[model samples]
Target chain A: MDVWNILEYCAWALAVLFGGHMLIDLARVDSTYDNDLLTSSREGEIELTQELHKL
Target chain B: MTLSSAEPTVQAQASTQGGERLQLLRVLGPGHVWALGVGIVLVGEYMGWNFAVGKGGMIAGLVACWLAGLLYTCVAMIDSEVTSTVAAAGGQYAQAKHIVGPLMAFNVGLFLVMAYTMLEAANAITIGFLLDTVAGLQGHSGLHQPPFIVLTVVFLAWLNYRGVLATLTFNLVITAIAFLAIILLFVSVQLGASHVPLDFSAISTDPLPYGWLGILAALHFGLWYYLGIEGTCQAAEEVRSPARSLPYGTMAGIMTLLIAATLTWYVCSGLIPWEYLGQAGTPLFDAARVTGSTPLMVLLFIGTIFSTLASANGCINDASRAWFSMGRDRYLPSWFGAVHPKYRTPYRSIVFLVPIALIFALGAPLDQVVTFSILSGLLGYTFMTFNMVMFRRKWPLGTIKRGYVHPFHPFPAILLLLICAATYFAVFLGYGSQLIAMMCFYILASLWFHFWRYRFVRRGDQFTMPWPRPQGC
Candidate 1:
């Protein structure tokens, strides 16, 4: 194979390795606690119920 | 100033600080953010491809930077007018959610987060690149290796994790040293100019020499220098007087940075050739190094480190605010909006932000990430400019308080829209590998996150940039 083809193979190999690493990183999401995501609000912020009611 | 009369001011401070506690030192003045802008601009110049363009390119790029500044100026004006009417927190996400429906606002907020995350990573990678370049010169060949990038990413993540006040104080010192370094370079160049002949031929050429194509390309990079101009508007509520200070601070920061950057480019261009700048790996540092002054070279290195650190710190502060606003609106999750009891900062959201930022910084190449940064930032500005026009019609002129207004009404506004649209289309066409890859990554992640947010993980209510109204039918 030509240099271009060989380089293409190398690029593909790197892509797969990196892509797998990213996926595995995502897979390791810490779900042990319900309070993990930055989504939860305090006990009584006014806008909470108001925004919910709009939905 | 009677001590007894000071009671009310103290009481007001006590209530505001005690009740609506936010990140300490977040309500920074325009001067601080302007310093941040300087750091960002110097970094942009470091990556700038002036050598490739030659004298003509340098002139073209500076003009483009001015135009990009104009676009930022317009957005800041619109934001100032809107800020006075609402007493709520959350910067662009809040304003957009209020004006537009929540769905559209949600998209913008998500895009904003993506923009910051990508940029944080991009900046980290750039810092790593500079470090590697410097190291390679010191005879270390493995400078481009992953370990270096990973280490820089970890360092930045640690700084961010220390909370807002620590970051801000640290940034203040970094920015101060950076400011001193840049000034020293300017002074040194001026003093040494007697040895070199001055050149003004770079600017005396035909304006728009490359026609619309060159103008568009320059504007694309120009937008890069003006990225954080509107950061103040996002942090308006945090400031002491949002009504007065927000408008003044936002505009002043953009203009000051523009002037400083223009002066730096002009002086540096005169002292050192554009060809040399473009060819050198770290052009700005190379400029100082070529001067043959060891003290000056050391100063520039210190300045670069300061610039990179301050930029990263400022970005983390601004980025987390976007998430905090979204969380409060119930779009992301309530936990994002949480303030640390003692520090009164967005500790949880910032915690989530730094790692994502590090991941991008560690993985991506500098140029790829910079292109994506410009793309995402311009997209945000374009929408904001368009939002202003729509806002003029939707909300009466009277509703927008007395503050800064664009010099020309629809003309400048229309021009902004066209420029923004053209740039967005150019990037989407996949000009660079990293831009194309990151755009795809962001779009896919946004879609996935949206489905998860609205479908399964959504809590009580969803928030958007331009907030949607209740269904009545």
Candidate 2:
């Protein structure tokens, strides 16, 4: 195979490599963690705790 | 190559399970924010703005550049005030969610994702085309471009997956080089160091082939000059201090784009005639070639490639943040919200968007991809005009703290609206069907949002910021 063809194969291989790594990591995280925990965030958490700091 | 994950710069000790966290790393400063904003936009100065020159001749192109500059200056002003107060990663989406309502925010978030992703698609396609051009010059015209397109998305997504600091720092370096390249070309042309002297009379010759209509037509393409400066706000949540960083970075970025755009137009128009400049794929590089100077040509070539890469890198960063923010609020599936335990990024969102970008990059025509991106951004800017008016009405200055306040309040908003209306007409003149198609696409997405996705959104919880009872409410 020529260099251009080899380069295309390398790109495909890297896409699979990085893309596969991400999928595996995503599955690992999804399977290992609870659904609620993975989905949970404090985006709108009201600052009830910070009230004491207000002078 | 093994990637090392980032350590938390600011610890969130809220979760006992050591897992659930809402925030990405707040490691970026104004410099990185500047990089992210400028990086996404500098690519246009290299290639796309010439279309404006083509549309209306040289003088018309200049007028459109200044008018769009005014439009974006208004955009930066409105975004600064709203984003400083909101202090969220999704930028305009978070502002709409809080000020307007859930439905508007959902659409805005979708706009952000689509705009940045399509721009990413455009950039990746450019890289492939750029490589193909290089291959052609080297007597090997048979280079397969799909691999390079695939390679661009994969590599940049991988970088974004690692951390925000490194990704943006990399953006900062390359963006600065690209910006410098424009300055170098300007200096070289002016000093008569280029192969040919600049022709001042090009501006006077055939200045407006289509009369006043050409200026209106140029407005649509003129957006390429400073299209993505408002994207600075997307880095808000990741900044060390959102209020300070967002406004400062955003303003600095707009100024940089302004000077860069003007210089680019001046240099390229002097070197190449408008008819040729308007349609040339790589106008700056072509300008370099006109001088017949190999070093300058090489410099412009490197600049184009760097600018394209920086844009794609910035797009991956912004698009993932928008998707992650939407997911975190359950505006979409919350599964996409998960930050990596080791790297402290929205890894799922970053990884997820790679294939979506790849689909468009591999499939669509470049102009189609770019048109969609520009229209999406235009829609977002139109939303900001209302967003600014409502923010002032609801909070009325003293009710809540803002890092920066735009002056001459209603003037910028009114001007912005007028400019937006004019540009809409401009787009309609050329791409009436595409404009209609885009509107229909948004309408369908909105319907889906109302019928299906609205149930998942935490409508009440989105109003988490501390504020007095909104004035009218």
Candidate 3:
């Protein structure tokens, strides 16, 4: 094979490897949580007060 | 001032902080962070790198991208360290404040905000152009209407104001679709019976069309491929286990970008003559059209739109966060720091940024806007890398609980600093006017800091680092 052919295949191989790694890394992440932190206005306000005091 | 009146000011400050706290929800995971990182620059891999090909042909363009990728790799490694260790909302700006000081942080914050906002505006205009072309709205009187740009920014800002989860979910889906589209394009090129074998020998002798100088000239376009991957670190405050997620997300994001960029350059250049492909605004779409398949062209067009949406959406998310961080630090007005009571997102900052981005989207040419963004971005990178060197001196290894550390201790930081310096100079030479504009912006930020903020702003103590701790027992 010529240089172009070699480089093309190498690019494809690298893409597969990297894509797989990214997927696996993403798969390991857990996103399950309650929306209370986002939705509860009172709780959010209280948390903000505490955070400001800490600062 | 009397103590009673001072009490009201303190109460107002507390209320402001409370509202700001309600804005950013801490729920993003490694996946969302990775998606944001990839989404922010996916459009560049799809379209902008072709300019590098125009400057230096295929080989030289590839070389420039390789150098840029190396620089980004070093940047990602060191940035992961700082982002994870600091675990703040401002990303590089926060790192600058902690490692250097607030004055430097102000400059870096403004540069970052400008770079991301400009990038967002560029994507908005590109989307309008794509829609115009796809719908055959060209050659019409209202080809580039400001209303369309305004509507697009408003829609995206509304999504941002809704919540971080909604924004990131949209980013994840669009980025995934875009990635698949690129892979599909690569597959079609490989398996199509009518595939034209690329004539590498045709341009072998004169790959450096403008000679070695073309390589340096191509640096800014080359940077387009992997420019905003560091943005994932900006979402550090919202991430769970930032010490772990920030490094993993950033590394994964860079690796993905590097691979996508290589495949893009290899496939698109091979499918068509580099000279023709280099000048086309939508090179990949044109390459698909050359295949003589209507469906392939339509698919790639849709892919381009998805990539554009992902970029603009990610930019809004990042830019608003940077603005909010500055507001929280009193670097900008406290009004910029306000969050939506119900949605828990930085609605005020998002609303404030939309018109600024829309104006640029409607007014500026693509090349100039892009150059301005890259110039400001490189300035921020230079500052962050220098700050990394100082951070290592202050913290050292084993001194603190670091999730990840760039091995070889300072070499990577030093190398990244040198690369940033060289690229900054190249950019300054290439776009002198933009550099001047950036310098003026920096000066304006300095004046704001010294004249107004330094005198009136009461900074919190969260950012104060305690060094040289008293000896145990």
True contacts kept of 1: 0.10
i-RMS of candidate 1: 12.4
**Which consecutive 10 residues in model 3 chain B have the weakest lDDT in total?**
B1-10
Q: What is the lDDT of residue B135 in candidate 3?
A: 40
Residue pairs with colliding backbones in model 3 are B23-B344
Candidate 2 lDDT, tens digit per residue, B52-81?
889888998999999999999999988888
For candidate 1, lDDT tens digit of each residue in B1-473? 12112333343345444453222223455555455444444455544534223323666667666776666666666666655434245566666755655565676776667666666676666666676666667666554434444444445544544444456566667766776666677777777723455465655654445655665565555666556656655554344445556666666666666665665566566656655653455555766766767787788787776677677666766777778777766677665665543334565676677568766676566666667667667757766776766666665454434444445566666777776776665454446565667668767766766666655434434332222332331
Worst 10-residue lDDT window for candidate 2 chain B reads B1-10
Rank by lDDT (best first) = 2, 3, 1
Better of 1 and 3 by DockQ: 1
Better of 1 and 3 by TM-score: 3
**Any runs in candidate 3 off by more than 4 Å, and if so which?**
A1-55, B1-23, B137-144, B193-195, B459-473
Q: What are the per-model DockQ values?
A: 0.07, 0.41, 0.03
Candidate 2 is scored at a TM of 0.95
Native-vs-model 1 lDDT? 0.57
Candidate whose DockQ is highest: 2
- Please report the TM-score between candidate 3 and the true structure: 0.83
Q: Report the lDDT of model 2 for residue B94.
A: 85
TM-score of chain B of 2: 0.96
